[model samples]
Target: MTQPSPLSDRRVVLAVAVLCCFLWGSAVPALKIGYGVFGIVPSDTATLLLFAGVRFSLAGALLLGYALATGKPVGLDRRTLGRVSLLGLVSTAGQYLFYYVGLAHSTGVKTSITTSSSTFFSAILAHWLYTNDKLTGRRLVGCLLGFAGVVAVNLSGAGLDLAFSVLGEGFILIAALLFSLGGIYGKRVSGQLDVMVMTGWQLGLGGLMLAVAGLATGGHLGGFGWEGVLLLAYLAALSSAAFALWALLLKHNPVGSVAIFNCLIPVFGVSLSGLVLGESFLEWKNLVALALVSVGIWLATARKDSVVGRPSP
Candidate 1:
C-alpha cells in the first residue's frame, strides 16, 4: 500500500479533531441548561453523576444499536473486555463524572480554563510513565503557548483574583489524569480490536458504570419537561457524537500527539458558553487567560514537520 501523502492524512485528522472540540465545547452550555432544567434535585455530586449517567447511557445504547444493525460484532473478547473496561472507567466515566461536578462549583469560563491544564497534566504524566511519545521541542513551545492562554483566561486581569479554587481545579486535574490513563491503555489495546467496536464497548461499559454510580448516590430521576428533555438530548447527541469521532481519530492517528487537541476544548467551550449561556466575555483577565491557554496548547503539541498543530505531520 503506497501510503497517502502525510499532508492529506494531517488534513483529515485536523478536521476531525476540531470537530470534536466544537461538539464538546457546544455541549458545555447545554450542560448548564441540563442542570437547571432537570427535576432530579440531588446535591451537586449526585446531580452531576446523573447527567453523566444519562448522557453516556444514551450514547452507549445508540452505538450498540448501530453496531448490531450493521453487524459490527460489538462484544469484546475476555482480555480486550478488561482493557476496554478500564479505559471506560478512566477516560469517560471518571473524567466526566468529575467534570460535571466541577462545573457546578465553578463558572463555565473557570471550568474551561481548568480543563485546558489537562495538556500540561498529560505531558507530565506521559513523561513520567516513560511513554514512547516524548514531547518534542516544538510541542513544548506550543504547549507553553497554550498554557499562557490558560493563564490569561484564568488569572491575568484585575477582577480575577489570584486565589486558586483548589477544589474546582483539583477535579479537572483528576479528569486529566484519567484521560492519560485511557490513552495509555489505548496504546496497548488499540490494534487488537476494530475501532468502532472498541468504542461501543468502551461507551457501553462506561455508561453502565456511571449509571451504577448514579444509583448508588441516589440520583433523582424526574421532571420530564421539554427543556429537560432538550438538554438531555443535547448532551447525549452533541457530546457523544463528538466523542465517537474523537475515538475514531485516536484509533487511526498518532495517540499522544492527538491528545493535544484537548486544549481546544477551553477555547470552544468558553466561547460557546458566553454566547449561549450569557456567560461574560469581556474580562481582560479572561483574554490573557485565553491567550495563555492558546500558547500552552501550542507548546504542548507543536511539531516540526507540520503546518498545523495536529497529531499527524
Candidate 2:
C-alpha cells in the first residue's frame, strides 16, 4: 500500500489550508450569533473587546493544554516568549481590535470584502520578505481573480458603492495588513520554535492584553447562561484548531501558497450566514464567486515550478 504523504505534501497542504479557511469562515456567522446571545451591540466596543479577549484567552489555554497532553515540549526561552508575545499582540489582539471597531462602523458586506484583502497583502509581503516566494504572473492573476470573486459575492444584494470612511473601511484594511504582517513574522519565528507552542503562547499573551484593555474600558458580558458558555467554548475551540493548523501550514509551505486559501473565508461566511441566520443564499453571484475562488486557488497552488519556502526533502 502507498503510504500517506506527509503534512507538507502539496495535496495535504491544500487540504489542510482549505479546512482552516472553512473553520475561519464559520466564525462569521458564529460571531453574529454570539453577539446576539451575549447581548453585544455594534456600538459596544468594550464588550466586543471583552468577548474577543475571553475567546482568545481560552483558545490559548486550550492549545497549551493540548500540546502538553500530547507530549509536545512546552518550554519557551525568554527570547521566544518575547517574540511570541509580540506575535500575540499584533496578530490576535490588535487585529481583532481593529476588526471589531471596523465592523461596527462598516457594513458586514464591506467588512467581509475588505478583510479579504489580507490575501493580497500577504502575497506582496512574501515577495519582499522571501526570495523564493517572489511575485509571479500566475500568483498575481490568481490573487486578482480571488479578490474579484470576493467583490462579486458582496455585490449580490448591494451593487458596488464607493462610500468610504477612515474608521470603517480603513480600519478593516489596517487589520488585514496587521494580520498579514503577523503571519509573515510568525513564519519567520516558526523556523526556531515549535508552531503549536508558539501559537499557544502568543494567543495567551495577546488575549490577556485584550482582556486587560477591555476591562479597563469597562467592558461587560451580559449573558452568563449555558448557551452563552457553550458558544464561547465553541469560538475558543475554533480559534485553537484553526490557528494551530494554519501555523503548521505556514511552517511547511510558501506564504502565498497558503494564504491564497483565505479567499474562501468570505465565500464560506456568506454561505454559512445564509444557512444559520436564514439570510438569502440563492444568488447566482454566489455560485460565480465560489467558482472564481476555486479557480484562483488552483492557479496559485498548482504551480510546480515555483519555489516553496520550505527546505527540500
Candidate 3:
C-alpha cells in the first residue's frame, strides 16, 4: 500500500489531538467509576488516593518501559533532569493529586470545566515566564472567555451533584496553576530530552512520589478488582499516550496553539458525561458559553497582526 501524503499525516495529527481531548475528557468519569467499583469516592479517602496513586504508578512505569525499550531512559542532562523533576512534582503530583481528589468531590462536567482553565492559566504563565511567549489583546480576551465558560458551566450545574462550590473550584484552580507551571517547565526542557524520555521520567518519578505520599496519608491500596484493572488501564494507556503526544506537540509546535485546544477539554468532558452518565445534552447556555470559549481560545492563542495560524488542526 502507498504511504499517505503529508496532508494526510497532518490530518492524522488533528485526529490524534481530538482523540487525546476525548480521552483526557473522559478521565473524570473514569475516576467516578473507580469510586463505584472500588468504593473510593468522597467517603473513601484511602481508596481514592490509592486509585490515583496506583494508576499513575502503573502509567509511569509503562512510559519508563517504553523509554527502556527504545534504549534511552536517562536522556536528560542534570540540569534538565532537575527541571523535569520540578515539573513532575508541580504538574504531575501537585496538579493530578488535587485534580483526582477534586474529581472525587465534583462531577465529570465540573471537573472538565475547572481543569479546562489550565489553558488560560498556561497562557498567562507562558507569557510571564517565557519572554517569547508574550500575550496579545486576543490572548487576554481568550483567557477571559475561557474563564467565563467555567462560570457558565458552574451555573449550569447549580442543582446537580457536579455543582461547583468555592472549595471545588479552588481545587480545580490549584490544579490549573500546577499544570501551567509544569507546562512552562516542559517548554524549557522540550529541547533537551526526547519527549518520550521526559514523559517517562516525569510520570514514573512523579507517580512514585505520589505513591509514597498516598501511603503516608493512609491512602488505601486494597479493593483490587476488574474495575481497578480497567481504571488503571485507562489511566495508563489513554492518559499517557495523550500526554506524550502533547509533549511532542509542545516540543515541536507553539505553546499558544496547544494551549488553545485546552478548551476542547470541557467539550469532551460534557460530551462524555452525557453519553456515559445520562446527563442532559447541550443547552443554549452551554452553546453560548462554548462560543465565548472558542473566541477566547482563538484570541489567546493566535498571532496578533500576522494572520498566519498555527499549523491547521
- Highest-TM-score candidate: 2
Model 3's TM-score against the true structure: 0.80
Model 1 TM-score, 2 decimals: 0.82
Candidate 3: deviation at residue 124, Å?
Answer: 1.6
TM-score of each: 0.82, 0.95, 0.80
Report how far off residue 141 is in candidate 2 (Å). 0.5
Candidate lDDT values, in order:
0.67, 0.87, 0.68
Clashing pairs in 3: 46-220, 138-299, 139-300, 142-296
Q: lDDT per residue, candidate 2, 144-250, as tens digits?
A: 89998999889944587679999999999999999998998898898888888899988888898888888999999888799889989998999999998998888
Residue 181 alpha-carbon offset, candidate 2, angstroms = 0.7
Name model 3 segments beyond 4 Å from true. Answer: 1-16, 73-80, 100-114, 157-168, 302-313
Residue 264 error, candidate 2, Å: 0.3
lDDT string for model 3 (54-142, tens) is: 67667767787877887875666778878878877886877877876676666655676677777867766656655455666767777
Instruction: Point out the higher-scoring one by lDDT: 1 or 3.
Output: 3
Off by over 4 Å in 1: 1-8, 40-43, 100-110, 125-132, 155-167, 282-313
lDDT by residue for model 1 (89-153), tens: 88788887877666556654566566766765666555555434566676667776765565555
